[model samples]
Target: MLLAASTQRTIGLVILAIVVLGGIVYIYFNIRSARNEVGSEIELASNRKPYLSDEDLEGKKLDLALGSSLVLLTIVAITLPLYWLGEPGRHEGRDLDTWRISTNRGEEIYLEGAQCVNCHGPEGAGGVVNTAITSSSGEFVAQVNWKAPALNTLMSRHTEDEILHVLNYGRNGVMPAWGSGGGGPLTDQQLEEIIFYLRSVQISEDEIRSQVDSGVEAGAKALILETSDEAWAVEVRAAEAAQADAAMAVRLLGRADFDFECSDDASECLALDEANARLTAANEAAVEPLDAAVSTWFDQVSAAKATADALVIEADPSLADEGNEDDLRAAALEILSTLDAFEGQEAYLQWGEILFSNTAAAGTYSCARCHTYGWSFDGASDYVLEENGRDGPIPELADGYVTAGGFFGPNLTGGSTLSQFETAIGQSAFITRGQAIGQTYGRGGSGGNGQMPGFGALTEANPVGPGMGPGSGIVFEYPALLTDEQIDAIVAFERTL
Candidate 1:
């Protein structure tokens, strides 16, 4: 049994008390004995009155003293060994306590000191940052609400060291460098504390799969809903065109044009008047219909998301209530297995496409962020087209990407994955376990830099698991980033890409 700190302290106090009381009793007896025997007043203290001769004194007296010393030595030998035996456990407890304290401090900083919860969401559920995008030469582009990735599943894709590196140097210019190395406020230890907090928030394998499935389902339904409102689409287009015209008009006016209350025959005054009228008319026209369309669209999107969320819950209500993940995973997998096409190229392929392009969890469930150029800040974000003209840095893409023609990762266009894996199973496996630095994967796929993240339960080198909470200890489970069926769907989509 582990000795609690309280119990240890109590034991120490008892031992000290015993030592103090024993000293007190010994002193009391010594004082009483020091009164000098009544018969020794006239004698040479006790020395003259001693009855034991040299022979008797050398016999039992010496033996008794020697025996007492031996007994005390035996106690010392026994107690020393026993104390040593408990030392290791005490040290382990101390270590555990230290980590626990560090985790608590880190959490405090995340929630309060650093206030990371503002953009990253409570418990690292993921959220958004409202900011403006800009051009290379410092021109304003558009207002954007960028999605911040969830830290709940972060360890599965990266190790503590890697996560620390990100904290030190930041990523994408969106997350500021928090560590001193990157010239921000935090020290290396503070960054490490953040990692410790992140470890604790990571969701379990079942929860990870559930989150992934939820996002996938949401994406799938959203894509179908993408074209459901043709009338709304038309209204949206009109608003966009009006917005562009307004922007162009605003651009046409020069600073000098507004300097004077224009002369009646001035060309500059006429041009300014025309531009202002165009801008006013455009705003009035675009605002109403677009607002109505936006409202209707949000309602539909919410309903779609709700429908997707209910799928797994409806599949196994008993499992859901009991929180039996193993069974729930089976039920989820059962649902997933039936998603493949009963008709043409398979319905799973649609799910796969959506999953690949999913924007949920800051595209944690999506591949486009890494595989498609400009996907991060492009029309993937909510933009104010009115503020931006047709010349916005990232316009709404026609079909959203060359559908993974590839950017950061190797292009899988033209049946590239087919040649690399030769079978869907092999590709699925590769995506599941992911790549390690200096470790190769597939046929001739060079693993230089080893950035391919695992989609399944990762262990060993990866931070893995929801490493947080009381009594969970430090050994974190490798998080399963995606289910087997989900990986298969993505693989199926990749083969086509």
Candidate 2:
């Protein structure tokens, strides 16, 4: 049986070979058949016109094949690269690009629009919002509650690391944590860039100190703004004349030579009597014009204040008729015109009061004790012994009088305020100044210079500074830290002042 099966397998293999040979023969015959059909078509065409040679036909076929190959290769080459290049990972989002642009240190970040000019100022030098920060008692203080800190002097005092920390972590409730630690919106690198920009700011402490020290002289000049430049020149000439008159009075008064008088009754001496009368006349004549000028200036200030008050009341619906908002606006314009008439009178009066006052109060100290009050190009004032016997030159008064004892109160007479003198300067300014001074001077737990006293819980909306706000006798003995609205109101009022 095995031998019979081997024989059958050999027969099957021969048959399979024969079938393969037959299929090849059949395909060869079909190719020849197609070539014959093409030849027939060409023969018919040749019968009608000039026939193509075999060489030319072979050349055309070769060219067609080569062109098709090249076209196929080109399509594959072009598409392969394009398919790979169009992958998702290659592109980034527009927001990411925008963020990169915004975070660049050299670029200017406009918070909102051109109106940023109105507050942040040209280079962010203590804008309308931040200028209100004051130092008192060695701590950083703010007159208003929930106010942003100034960026101007921050570079001078704060380290880059500290600034970055603040930017990331924010301050109090008002300043949000802008760093990852506080779930901030900005990335760590963005925060660092901001810090770098802030650190680059350069502010002159010397210039600020000089300005603070010159408060008195600035006040004196403020008083004479109502007089025209020509009038001022005339006044100057009058002042010179007064000086001569004063000199003449001194010479004629016989008081200059009181020691030479031999009369038992000096009053009975005719020469002395005549001299006294002449001296009195000259003194009176020299002072008359100056007195008149001062009176007129004050009158102008009073009138302007009345006009401004009226306008303010009209603009406020609570104070005026709500139905006449437009009318109130027109009225405000009229008031502004009246205010313009007064011109520099308000400043002059304020400055005069600051210059001549025995005691000054603002924020936390006396201005007279720390600045000069008289006129001199070189910046010094002569000592005027007050009627009460207080004596010191302007430079002497400015030395360390306010900060000497470490807790000297500031003068607020000529400073900005919110409500009345007591509310604005006494309460608000003092609290803020005390906080800043405390931090700067190193008097608080934070451990700073300790040059001034600390406001403690009083620095915050709730009690956070020492002393619990300013003392009693003026406004509230210890008022709460000011609100943002109150601060704004105070600032608005201060700008007017």
Candidate 3:
């Protein structure tokens, strides 16, 4: 109430004052009037002359006493059962009120108390969080913008209990543990309230699809707008075309024709060497302009993205009802979408590499944490060890560290992944559902717990009945670990390993 606008608060205060004064006056007048009426009646009775002799007066008194007793009996008979009949309804009403209060508190925690909006954004929409990359000892390293996933659609991925479990324990190093058991700030009840808030913000599947489709179209528009400059666009297209031609020229030049492995004195070997050198020089020359063009295009894209981000911020609303879809649409269409040379199969594998290593979620959870030994982070670091005082600097790995090597998890290198899964779909499925406790997965893999999180939607092993307890009417799906496209990319990358 204190945070309300000045005009609104003033109006509220005035109204409250009026109500309080009115109630006081009403009670005072009613009490005074009742007392006055009783006094007047008593005085009238005391002053009245005797209506009969002693015997007649006694008889009249007896009759009055009997009449008063009968009236009192009749009033009790009507009211007693009514009060008892209303008891159960009153209890149910109290329970409902309690739930409503808890839900409101949960919203408060999500918006203010827990500071979830810093990463998740308003109404549980995902957003980018800019923070400094720090070592385990709290030394500053570099700045990074981490991507937080949307919580509004969280139910489509995980059940309420699974979400509750995550709330209790947190994930990776990015998301701090929130429950008391994990030594965070919130209690179990408070966490539940946060979940309730999340429940209220969910959108329909049709709306989600529409938003995604609109974004794709908008992205294409932004791209065309950026590259619409005649001179720059023409230069970019020419450079790209030249690079493709150079690449094809290199491929067409057969290795057998340039076999320098033959005796250097041989005439054919000398001729082939000269030809190979000329082609290599031509390819290198073509690459230079291509690189410059790509750099310029990337800069433009970055600028466009920054503009879009600003628009998105303007559109963001704290409450679902206040959201401005027009602003969101404008922001989504700010950047240009372009065709990439590495589309189709090549793109999937490349994307997988990014997802495998990217610290998008709270700067912690990623595939490399378990699968790759010393890839880019200290795989040994865990919440349990950190709590037990095993604090140390997180050793940073050099770029292109030995990927797919075994660390905390199994080795995925040297065809090990392909051998286990047999097919890409198998690999994808394994990633989607993950391994349950003591459940066998893949070829000869066993004794696994639910350590490997699922990337797609998951079903609960056991769901509660509608009347299991309070709030049982509410249901939730297990949160997805990854999207289908993302999982496909990871699977492709793993196969390469």
Candidate 4:
């Protein structure tokens, strides 16, 4: 009965319980009646010998036992196969429940356990990450705001495994690794759940493209407003006139000369002070027209950007049914193929630079961060350190110090890349799969552990940490970080450098 309740064997147990209770009650009444019968028989046969056959009672008992065994065997034969047949459905239901629970747990970890939402935003839209800087001994140094990337479109940029690698090992000591391999805190199961949650938040490619185009259009409109307006020209001319009048006034009063000694005589000092006051007034007046022009331009640009963003939202293609998977793939491919139009153009090289330095998205997940000397960014200077293991007052780059020269990673300038890679394809491939631990890369470059992250696919497959449980040794396939055209553009830019 205890086993039945524990295992939830309800139907059979309920029947058995009823049968056992009935037998106990019947035996209680039967024993009481037998005791009365035996008492009467003993009184009647007080002084007489009884005659009876014991074989008849034994025959009746045997017959009853045989009948009960036949009934039990019949029931078992009918129920066993039915129980076996129901197992497949039960297994499927259990799996579904497990996945549902995992997804929920992942969302919780993203929001609360990991506090990823603080940097990535509530919807993973990205935001500023403000952290206090400290010395090795935990001295307060500085505070900075780092731009965190939008995870809503993360899948479009990187694969599951690539994202996992980042989660495990971290980046440049800014993003702390969360897996055990890098001495992080999260278990392997938690990492997998986070991936599941990310999959649910992905936006369509069409929407992404539309938003990008809107940004470009808004920038163009702002540029045109700055240069092409007649009102702006008038304001600039007025500002120039006022500024000249102020300069002339100062000059006539001799306030422009540094050695014009007026401290000894009271009258000379008073006159000098008056002239300085007039010059200050004129300078203040000169700024009004310029400030108005600048403010107007900013307002117009902001309004234009808002309108463009709204239009993009309204024109999103994902709202409508786009046919089969093949059709969607073809449409996406066509849009991606247009990136090649910038090939061999000057703009291509400039685009590569933007990709290398831009920290608005994905933080500073760019090549320059690893390649350039002290090239860490926090919404301020791109290069934070003047030299290794020291805080800075950075020197001027008067000698045109190579920006992409070696720092944490190797130097890409000085024709070294050209020597390593003979063709564009070879360079692109090397950029795709960065240096893994114990693995040699382009030309004679030695392996430097898993320091370099691959932009194409993950090179390290087996799980790195001990926290990974059963079936953790399998490889995680990730999506490429940069598109083929983007990689090609970077290759072109690096070759020129």
Pick by lDDT: which candidate is best?
1
CA RMSD of all predictions: 10.6, 29.9, 19.3, 14.0
Tens digit per residue, CA lDDT, model 4, 35-73: 322332434456766644345644777668866885785
How high is the lDDT of residue 449 in model 2? Answer: 26
**How many residue pairs clash in each candidate at the backbone level?**
3, 54, 12, 2
Candidate 3, residue 89: CA error in Å?
Answer: 5.9
- What lDDT does the true structure give each of the candidates? 0.65, 0.39, 0.56, 0.57
Sort by TM-score, top down from the best: 1, 4, 3, 2
lDDT by residue for model 2 over 284-368, one digit each (tens)?
A: 5535554565566556644654555575784564647667654454344334322233454354335323432212112111222
Model 1: which ten-residue window has the lowest total lDDT? Answer: 461-470
lDDT tens digits, residues 56-123, model 1?
86689987997798679657755654575566567767766877877888899899988889878999
Query: Which residue pairs clash within candidate 1?
Result: 200-468, 341-346, 341-347
Please give the distance, in angstroms, between residue 153's alpha carbon in candidate 3 and its true position after superposition. Answer: 2.4
Report the lDDT of model 2 for residue 426. Answer: 36
Per-residue lDDT tens digits for candidate 3, residues 29-104, read 9768764222322233666884565466557797799679857855564455445545545655775676677668
